[model samples]
Target: MIESARNLDALKRRLASLDRVVRTRHAHFPFGHAPLDRMLGGGLARGRVHEFFACEGGEAAATGLSLILARLAGPQATTLWLRPSAAARQGVPYGPGLTALGVDPAHLLIGVMQDEGMLLRAAVEALRSPALGALLLEIRGRAPQLDLTASRRLTLAAEQSGVTALLLRLDADPTASAADTRWRVGAAPSVPLPGNAPGMSAFDLTLLRHRGGRDGVAWRLIWDNERGLFGDGRDERDDHGRQGEGREGGAPLSRASLSFPAVRPAADRAA
Candidate 1:
């Protein structure tokens, strides 16, 4: 009887493991941007470390990138935002916007490192913890080539422990390591929004890279700081937009034409 009971327990454990694998395979962030979410193969998974390497030349792009991190952190989940103090204080006042989105401000653990090594190490360790829902590493400029092995280990750790880490950095850095998804963001001044007043905060959000697809598809969005929400941008020239996704007259929103808007300054631009 005891042997049978032990076997049953093992079987239950196995089933649980299998269930997790199935779920992790389709990890995603529900950012309310269907087009953007669809492009990400259903958005970023919880157990995987997805890095965003930001490219140069655009506030629309940069702001959109910050929103991506904020979205992954979710409305109310524990987050560990690791970066330098100066970055946390001056360059980006990102936490307030996150709180505005409904996240528990107190639950956030903003860690500042004296050196790069400590920062990366803390990042690796943080992902290993079960309490954290997401780990965000904001890089202001180029991604330095510190230790590939270490980076790989961190990636493996995230996968093993079922935690998500986002290595957010600039695009100009040619030496950055390969990531699950690579994006080049830029601000397109002319991008339009779908609803409300035309001039209400907005940006040109481009999806520069997907795991397995062509690049250069993007979205234009209207960002309203007063109300922390993003909506589609309606441009007449952008005949295919969120407005006309299905109906005959509806503009067919392309991966390129649609915009993903976000409220201003998640903290300040890191550099």
Candidate 2:
């Protein structure tokens, strides 16, 4: 037993050394929102772990924003999304709706794990793969399994593989983790279209924590599905109802009275 323990320790040391040597330079992607992007020092860092926590009644907004980030992080690569089987009751990703959000549903691979343990294990493995451009782990509630150690493991894997990892926590509070950034997301009123129709997906995002930057900053972002980017919540409408130059300190939009469903059933034909 002592000999076996010694070998295990030696193996761990070797793995740690390998991890240090395999570090890849982290990259950043712009959110397209000038203020937010500037605050993020160009954009959010890639090849790092980021956490998004959903506020009450904002589960859908959190999920939507996370999905958008995943797509942006790996526009040309496949994204692996891991979730617990229990989340199926909430809803599945509607392919058509995802397409409407500028995310190619075909490039997204969803994995339904039996439990949180399995889901986290799969997330770590997925993050370690260089072929995967991004990984999203949807853990509803307080995920006890995703402790600091587990987060560190995922971060290390992402750093080595150059894959961005996103953690979406539904109905959960923030906890200790190795994530490079953390956010609180909620639904915001979207700018109405010409005929009072839904203009674009909007979100209220609060930067709860940033590893090497400022935090506690809040922004209202509008997701432009056509451009596949985000805009500052400025009412910049032209005569043709098109977006114009956004100015700072614009009037705040009214609170989102409309409900936006975050996830829809894949079986829903109406989607």
- The 0-to-1 C-alpha lDDT of every candidate, in the order given, reads 0.51, 0.73
Tens-place lDDT digits, model 2, residues 138-182: 998878989999999999998877889999999899999999999
Which sections of candidate 2 miss by over 4 Å?
1-26, 232-262, 265-271
TM-score of 1: 0.63
lDDT of 2 at 140: 89
lDDT of 1 by residue, 1-271 (tens): 0011012234233223321212234466544455556656766556665655554555335645554455454434455667654454444434444444334455455566655666676777766665666777756654463445766877787887777777766534534443555554455343344663234434455554455754455555544344444554442112223444443366464333323333334443323
Q: At residue 174, give the lDDT of candidate 2.
A: 95
Model 2 score (lDDT): 0.73
User: What C-alpha lDDT, on a 0 to 100 scale, does residue 46 get in candidate 1?
Assistant: 60
**TM-score of each candidate structure, all chains considered together:** 0.63, 0.80
Give candidate 1 misplaced runs (Cα > 4 Å).
Answer: 1-26, 55-64, 73-75, 89-96, 99-104, 146-148, 174-176, 187-203, 221-271
Error of 2 at 216 (Å): 0.4
Error at 126, model 1, angstroms: 0.7
